[model samples]
Target chain A: MLRFIISLWASKLCLFLFKHTGRERDDRPGILALRLCPNFLDRVKKPPLVVAVTGTNGKTTISNLVSNILNLEGKKVAYNTWGANYKAGQARCLLDAVSIFNRPTKDAAVVEVDELLSYKTLPWIQPNYVIVTNICRDSIRRNAHQDLIFSRINQGVSKLPNATLILNADDPNSSFLGENNNKRFFAIADQHADVFETNVSDFPVCPKCGTVPVFNYRHYRAIGNFYCPNCGLKSKTGDFIGTKLDFDKREMLVKEKDGEFKYPLVSDTIFNAFNIMAIITLFRTIGYSPEVIAEHIKHIKLPENRVACEDLGKIKMYTFSAKGQNVSAASTVFEYLAKEPSKKELILLLDEHYGDDPNIETITWLYETDFEYLNNENIKKIIVAGQRYLDYKLRLRLAGIPVEKTVCVFDEQTIPDYVSTDGIESIYVLHDVTTVLRAKKIKDKIKEKITNQ
Target chain B: MKIEVLYPELSNLYGDYYNAKYLAMCIPDSQTVFTSNNDKPAFLSEKVDIICMGSMSERNQEFAIKHLMPYKDKIKELVDNGTFFLATGNSFEIFGDHIEDDGKKIECLGAIDFYSKRQMNDRRNCFFLGDFQTEKGEDIKIVGHKSQFSFSHGKATEKPFISVEGGFGINLDSKNEGVHYKNFFGTYILGPFIMLNPQFLKYLLRSMNLNDSLLYEEEINNAYADRLKRLQREGTEFLMGAE
Candidate 1:
């Protein structure tokens, strides 16, 4: 008890100092608290309902949505909304939820956790509900492959005996986790996107059989309605089905057990619909009424700085925070940009990491990314920035983009100077998680350049 | 000419399929056969100019070994006849003696003398900078990435493919990496080996009797040069630690 008090005091002091120093108190308080009390998490009084959101993508958005929806339902919720998903950040979130005496203040907690840190976080928190967004190929150096991540997540989930797993039915890799556990699935109905062969899909062969799985309709990459003809393996019908996507109206229809409900769309992308479905499924499973969820969904706002747009007089500039070392994420963003019916120039700041001494070396993920999307005729110029600009330029050229359309700038700071503002209607600044600040600065520079012109 | 990609569905991790894709780009008229794991490899029934396979997950590695075990003699014959073969990343482990994972051992094709052991916890990932010497005594710099959960052990009966100029080789102990049996080339390096190493790809094209001229030669060479320079300047600090 004394140790817990001392650790709590130390954590409070560290957080106070961090705020005074004007630093973002994301992980340091938790790190200090954990260091002071090695078993700090074990001693904390968890909220009545503890839910954890984890996966390769959509974790942050889904976690934030859960917190927002719960708050709208007049419930006190504690969550990691600052984009800190690791163990240290989770510790800080839990700390924030409690009083100085370490008693729970919130009715529930919606924590976002890093997939790799599941073993470290799950056993201690022992969440009542675990939501797994679809798992896919991620950073080559850190993640290696999807199987490695799947194993780690599975190992962590196995530690919790009573937790219900919320999975994506579209993904066979994640949906397979529900075989012998208390689980519910969420899926988007087939949009009938053209099914073509892609080398980037993580699951090609069926898990049950060695034969290639036939896709009824592939949404994008590997996520879709698929079944193995040889083994008769197929995706189970989702408990919550998202359909009738009206991107212009920014709304989608969710079909649950109690008739259909109209849910406000977070974004037009199919991934966002899946994220919404996951959140709705969780709340519904927890015995929340569909009427209440629909009422709360209207007020839900997506976390900012992921996708932003600014108008610079005649030039409209957009910035997308594409996850680094993730080929699928970047390819999705590029595909979104390709669909725009306007003359555009693109700035790619896709380096995995950044700093004065950034050790960004692995460029293999670039090959997996569909750079061919940028080969559209409307995209007049592509300015490749950061340390691996040469590699990006090579990939673009190899992807059939004309060499004349590509420009490489080794330093990211000089990006605005190279971006041609002439005749282009929009300039898209694509950045990774680590380089968000740099992207903002680049965006500012472009806006200034356009204003000056 | 037919370029056969063995089990592309399972073995295309780490974007290593681009090695074959880039090769086909260099030789536009070449026919590319993408064989699935359930089906027999095209190299068994038909004449194949180049055979390629890339990285896969650990479980898929075991399945690949089983799928190819039936055609061990055919693989041996292909290697003996000097058929051009390039196996990158974990796919190279399939040709080794055996792969041990969590105290269980799965026998590989045993085409090479060495055996591989998977370190599930310790995955070694690094930037590889090496020199591959051609028959004409010319040095071609090989620059790529290596992200693997396992490394090979034991002595190579013949010579290793490339001498490591930077990063860990075949295993942590040896500076020699991969196996260079006849025309069969296997390496742990991913990065779509051919895309990053234009000079090495030129040599490979020459060996295949295709036109030695590479597509996007200038851009590819520039990328390789920039990578090599960065690796030399950064040295070991840039190498990722195996966790």
Candidate 2:
């Protein structure tokens, strides 16, 4: 008890001091707390209603949407606004939720938990609702494979047998979590399901027969309607189904167990469509009315760090984040950029950054990404900048991209000098999360060059 | 040149299939034949210049071993006769004596003198920088990454594919990495092993009696030089977790 009080009060003091001192990156409080008391999470006071949103991707957007809806409904809610999804970040989130006296002040808390770290976070959070967005291939250093991550989540969910699991029926890899527990599913009948193609596929085999299940409708790698020919293992239908998605119209019709209702599409990307579906399913399962949820969702926009667009007269530049070492995320961004009808030039800044972590960066994930999408004739010149620019160039060459079409620069700031604004309608600056601020500066430099041109 | 990929549908884990794709790009007029688990491998029936296989899940590894058990002698003959075979990640384990996971042993094709022990609780993730000596006695620096649940044991130092300068090889404490018996080369290091090492790819092409001119030779060499400098830098971490 004394340890709990000391850890909590000490962390609370750290948060206070950090906030006053303008230490915007305040994960130190949680780290300090954990250092002082290893099991501080188990002893910390939590809100009566806690929801943990977790998956390989889309956890942040889903958790944010859920928390936004709850806040709009006049419930005092606490969530991790900064991108801290791990155990230390989660500890900091909980500390911020409670009063200085260590009593919970919020009515509810929506926590975004990392998939690999879920086994550690879920047991302590003891959430009433566990919303899983989807499971896909992530970094090999962090997430070895989907099987390992699935097992980790399974270990976490096993502790909370009564917690309702909100799953993505579209993802076969994640849909089967907590098989015996109560599960509510959300699915989207992808309009562009058949057109998906990629080199890296984390396809799931049938659990019973050990056969690779054939997909009836494959939206992208390992996602869609699948059925095993050997064991008759089939994909599950969702309790909440999103249909008639019109990307241009920015509208979708959602059918729930209660009734069918029209909701405004939050984003045009297929993954964002799934994110909205997961958010809707969670809100509806937790007794939020459809009308109220839709109203709040209409105001929520995709975080600029994920994707942002700027129109510099006739030349449009888009800053798209292709997460480092994440194959699916990079592939999605590449495919999306390739589908755009405008003549494009690509400025790739997708190098893994060496932060405080001691591990050497792995470059194997580059082969899995769909760099072939950039081989289209519409793409004029590809400018790659960073220490690993040659690695990307080699992968692109193997993808059948012409040698003359690619330009390599060791210095990222010099990328603008090689970018060709002539005969191209727009330039796409594809960047890694670590290089977002650098991407913005590159975009600004390109904007200046265009204005001077 | 013909490159036959064995059980690509099953062994296509961790993006190691790109090694085969890259080899094809380096070799002119090369045709790739992808043989699924249900289909018989083309190498078993025909003359192929190279046979490639990537990684797979442990469960699928069992299925792969079961499917290939009948051709153990054939695999041995091909390896002895200098048929170039490249197996990346744990696919190389399928050619070993056995794989011991959690006290249970799954017998593999005993073509090699090694066995693999798997620990479900511990996964080894690290960067591998090694010295690879080519057939012409030219020494080349080979760099790649290893992320796996199991590591091979027993007599791996007999003819290792590469000498480990950094990171763990085969197991936690082995400086000798992988197997290099005759023309068969198997290793856990795969940064799409071929794509990352252009000089090694050239050596591979030269050994296969093809024109060793690599596509984008200058850019690839520059990239390799940069990577080598970074890997050799003091305090650059080669291991992630406990050694």
Candidate 3:
């Protein structure tokens, strides 16, 4: 209780200092507050429609998709597209939209929950809808494998009275959670040929029976139509249909038992579409229309970090994906890589600064992706840079990349050493949220050189 | 070489099935089979020229050993003959005398020259770098990651894997190329390891003289070469000197 009083006093102090800190990029008060009260998520008032999103990848993309879909249904939504999902950060979000008096702002709160924290605090919020994009191998350093995280997510979502569970049908781990007697909704990529790779950490055999699964086809990472050869329960998602994947237009066409409609793909990945499918299903369950969803997608773009392509000599993209337990970010990474014939050489930088605890445990979803599938004739190399260079290197190595093929640059200044002034005319960069600005500086220098040319 | 793959419940960090497929692809039409978490049988079959193992939790290790007791003498015989087995993450540790968890000691097959201790801070990593050789005696390197915890500490007198902060590695991928063994290779490289590095498969085939019996498609061969070059040229990850 005394700690709460101190935290209350600190919260008031933070609110007061919110106006005083000018141009200070450091999250001092935030860090202090977060450290002081680890379970700060309990502080926020439970909103009407508290939706918790999680996975090894695609958490944020789905959050944006769901939030926008809700907005289209004429409900106000407040969320973080930048993957700001920690408790205090989420608190700041609630404080940002609502009045200083802690009143509700939008009709619903679509919160992007971190994979690790999803298990920790979802029960506190008692979310109306809990969407787990899919569980692949992520963050084994800190947590267990997919099944454990899946159980934790279910535990949190189940705590909410009549809370709906939305999952990916194609994912072996994610789909398994639906077996429970809960109000579960499942969505999947229409075709086995996926747009984005699933983030996989470990090879999963049937827990019930130890048998290697036969994958009819691999979508990404560990997600696909898999049936355990021994148990014969590998995968049963044959008729499980989803929206047709249209990468060019970035629109989702979903058909239900009653009717069929198109939901715009906020980004160009089937994995994101998978989450959007969950969003639409939840919205429809809570009484929403496809027309409103279309309207909402027109202006909804919280995943704004997704940038347009620029041709240097080769087409390189400068995008931001997730680090730590942010599977949504991983999904974004796979989406960009899976788009073409893996022609665009990727430079993925995972910065621990995105979250306070950048434990590699949450980032273990690196294995769930198909680095080889993306390794077409066009793909040159995957450069890992930033504070946590070794972490990314380790993830890529475990993904079956030969050590000789990967490059790591711990020093920020050395990044330019690899930049060809004019050969491959493109650079696809995925940066963490906190490191996005620093990444931009590097990009800006390159852009200026190209512009001058 | 007919490789025998072991999907131990402990070594399966990053889709150990990929590693199984990878090794099978490298061998002569090798048949990849699955073993349950607790299905360790002795004198099972002589057909397995090479063995590949997967990952498992600590309890699963106990489960495997609990069943493997009857097969201990056979397993020990195979190990002594260097019949060739590949185990990664916690699976290899189980082959040792024992694996310590939560201050409680769990009995292992006691094949290797050491014991494995599982700890949180000791993370081997998901990706790694490796240097090995091709069939034509060409120097090659591998990149992939997994956890390989538990050191031999002069037990088997095996060298280290390039070296990293937390022991050898607890994750699936190695920090260096190739899981070096006298034909008995074990690595933490995910995607089942072999599928990720098709070059390793190509090299293994030629090394085993299966190239004459196997149809090596130019498309697949060129694709592998191109990928290596592309990763080396444009990719941010590379072997030590290449970096």
lDDT of 2 by residue, A140-241 (tens): 788877777888899999999889999999898899899778999988875765455777657646755667688788766677888999889888899999
For residues A224-338, what per-residue lDDT tens digits would candidate 1 score against the true structure? 8888988899987898888777888988888877788888887877777888889889999999887788778888877766778888877889888777688778877777777
Residue A41 lDDT (model 1): 82
Q: Give candidate 1's whole-model lDDT.
A: 0.83
Instruction: Write model 2 residue lDDT over B1-243, tens digit each, in one string.
Output: 899988877777778788887788767789999887777888877899999998777877888898899889998788889999899888999888999999899989888788999997888887889998986788989888888899888885456789999888877778878888877889998648887788888888888889999766886787788778889888878887622
- Per-model TM values vs. the true structure: 0.95, 0.95, 0.68
Give the clashing pairs for model 2.
none
Q: Compared with the true structure, what per-residue lDDT tens digits does model 3 show for residues B1-243?
A: 455445443445555655565455445546656665445532386556666666665445555566676677778778777675766545656566776765977777766665556653343443354455543556555545454334333244344332332213422243332234455455444434554455666565554456632223442344344334433443333222100
Residue A199 in model 1: lDDT? 52
For candidate 1, chain B by itself scores a TM value of 0.95
For DockQ, the strongest prediction is 1
RMSD values for the candidates in order, in angstroms, are 2.1, 2.3, 8.9
| Candidate 2 error regions (>4 Å) | A190-194, A354-360, A451-453, B134-136
What lDDT does each candidate get?
Answer: 0.83, 0.83, 0.56
State residue A385's C-alpha deviation in candidate 1, in Å.
0.7
Q: List the residue pairs that clash in candidate 1.
A: none
Docking class of 2: medium
DockQ of 3: 0.10
